[model samples]
Target: MVFFFLSGKFDQLQHAEPLSAIKTAFNQYFFNISKSDDERINTTRSSILETAGDCIRVLTACFPGLEKIIGSHCTNPTKVGPKETQHRFEYAFRSMVKAIATPSNPVVLFLDDLHWADAYSLHLLTVLATDAYSLHLLTVLATDREIKNFLFIGCLR
Candidate 1:
């Protein structure tokens, strides 16, 4: 079995990456397969963009691959209620995880230092974990044993 490990370490560098874990995972996945011109990958890219064009447009600034996949013509997503916005993010991320992970070659996302992880990263983790069973993906999270930061823990609830 092939296993891909994506590790994102959250440290004191707050200015380094805003959404550390999410940025790390997304960029890592894209970077690894960026050279491929496979038809299936192209199809997945198109499907993701068609299904979540607005969300992808918002994310292009963060993930460069989105811009390459969907081009620069995408406009800002329509302004929606908070719940609808959250749903869009969730759906986009779920599609991304499914695109990369497979039963034969599982992907593992290891996010360390949850205490230092931003609220957005923790929220994204919670969203992915909520749909873990269907994604065929594994997530490993770590933080200081003393549990000084309860923010990430609270996100699970």
Candidate 2:
């Protein structure tokens, strides 16, 4: 989704790397208390949670997992256009989020520093935000007001 817009073409994909300046502070407080699920998922989510080691395990585990499946288009990927990958990324992200969320526990999906996020990421956010009612999601997006305005303007077109 990430691209260098030196020209008017979609250029580079977002590198599958660790997010160093990670974690977003929420304005709305989340109560971590939830009913216990009858079936617990065996996810290593606790390791890369918004803790001191958040970005550490993400590089080796989380981001790679996302990149592997969602970023699977390898045949002249740059020339394939944005629509192709946006749906795939959104589906993968939604599935992952849904799998981790339960009635007892809600999912807090936060994307920070969105000014640097790729087009696909932005597109995914637009999709998720539009369909927020269907999912048990608390989506928090962070960016400068100017960038938000720009995104809004671009989205309208």
Give me the candidate number with maximum lDDT. Answer: 1
lDDT tens readout by residue for model 1, 1-157: 7677887778757724567666776677666655557764576577667656557765666678656655688777889999887787677677667656767757888888878887777777777778854377888888898757787778767
lDDT on C-alpha atoms for all candidate structures: 0.71, 0.37
Clashes of each: 0, 0
What's model 1's overall lDDT? 0.71
Candidate 2: RMSD to truth: 12.6
Judge candidate 1 at residue 146 and give its lDDT: 78
Which residue pairs in candidate 1 collide? none
lDDT of 2: 0.37
Candidate 2, poorest ten consecutive residues by summed lDDT? 2-11
Stretches of model 1 off by over 4 angstroms after superposition: 15-18, 37-47, 50-54, 73-75, 81-83, 132-134
Q: Against the true structure, what is each candidate's TM-score?
A: 0.75, 0.43
Q: How many collisions between residues are there in candidate 1?
A: 0
